[model samples]
Target: MGDYVLLAISCILVNNILLAQYLGCCPFLGTSKKMETAIGMGMAVIFVLVMAGAITWLLEAYLLKPFGLEYLRTIAFIIVIASLVQFVEMFLRKSIPALYKGLGIFLPLITTNCAVMGVCLININEEYTFVQSLVTSFSYATGFGLALVLFAGVRERVLLARVPKPLQDTSIGLVVAGMLALAFFAFKGMA
Candidate 1:
């Protein structure tokens, strides 16, 4: 239990996929302009990452490994992740119309989101047990969520702040992201 807790914390803070590993920068930059959108995107990503991790782990252990299909890991994992995303999107549209609307375009965009795929790959490469893989996936998603929300807040403030003409939009966002990444580095020794 202690180790699980530590793994979650370390993954969330120390080895954050977005800030530390630099995965999924596209959505992190593109959808962070509005807090609402950022939250929606983050939640969508969390759902997909966790689900993708579980599915990929199962495939790797049961199907891929058994048939000596390790070489096809990337392609298989991607297919599963893409299919899972589609299923989730459809389910959300039917069962949670409000959330589906809230997520809007980001829902489909998650299929190509590198962070989700990255988590799946990490789980396979790390050879985490089933429970550990789930924990790590959730932790990674939490960290991604934290970063997205934080970036959204900062971007919101930036909208109101007086700034030079050149560094107003993406330039400022990039600088802010860099600083956030640096701040996250402080958690490296926590575990």
Candidate 2:
């Protein structure tokens, strides 16, 4: 239990897939312009990441490993992640049209989000137990949500602030992201 808890914390903070690993920045920067969209995107990613982790772990352990098809891990993980993203998109579209629309094209873009695929690959490569992988995946998603939400708050404030013409829009966003990444790096020492 303690190990699992520690692993979760490590993934969420010290080894954040987005902040530390810098795997998925597309939606992070794209949807973060607004709090609602960032929240929606983050939730969608969390749901898909957890599902992909579980499904891909089973696939690697049972189907791929048994058949000595380990070489196809990348392709297999992407397929699993992509399928999960599609399912999420359809579910969101029907259950919550506003969120689906608010997310805009970012919903579909998650299919190619390397962060999900990276979590799947890491779970398999690390040889984590089923439960551990699930926990790690959830933690990673939580970290992503935490970052996006926090950054959204910052962006909302930045919108009203006076800024130099040269450092507007994404330029300022990048600067903030760099600072945020550095702040996340502070967690490394805590581990």
Candidate 3:
């Protein structure tokens, strides 16, 4: 139990997929313009990441490894992620039309979100057990959500602040992102 707690902390604060590892920057920057959209994207990512991690681990353990078909891991993982994205898209579109519309193109883009792929691959590469993979997946998604929401909050504030013409919009966004990443670096020693 204690090990799981540390693992969660490591994934969330230390090895964050966004601030620390720098995956999923596309949506991180795109969907983060609005707090509501950011929250929606984060929740969607959490669901997809956890499900993908579990499914991929089971596939690798039961299907790929047993059949000596490990070479197909990438292709298999892509298919699984794609399917999960489709399910999320459909569910969101039907249940939460506003968020679904707000997410727009970024919703489908989750299929290619490397953060999801990266964590899945990390779980396999690290040879984590099933429970560990699940923990890592949830923690990483939580980290991504935390970073995205925080960045969104900061970006919202930056929008209202006075700024030089040259440092407006994306220019300042990049600077803020750098600062946020640096702030997250403070947790590196905790692991």
Backbone clashes in candidate 1 total 0
Q: Write the per-residue lDDT of candidate 3 for residues 1-191, one digit (tens) a residue.
A: 99999999999999989988889998998998999999999999999999999999999999999999999999999999999999999999899999999999999999999999999999999999999999999999999999999999999998899999999888888899999999999998765
- Which residue ranges in model 2 land beyond 4 Å of their true spot? none
* Candidate 1 TM-score to native: 0.94
lDDT of 1 by residue, 25-128 (tens): 98899889988878878888888888888889999999999999999998998899889889989888899898788777778878788999988888878889
**Candidate scoring better on TM-score of 1 and 2:** 2
lDDT values for all models? 0.89, 0.91, 0.95
RMSD per candidate (Å) reads 1.5, 0.9, 0.9
Write out the backbone clash pairs for model 2: none
Give the count of colliding residue pairs in each prediction. 0, 0, 0
lDDT of 2 by residue, 32-150 (tens): 99999999988998999999999999999999999999999888888888877888989988999999889989988998787888888888888899999999999999999999999
lDDT for predicted candidate 2 compared with the true structure: 0.91
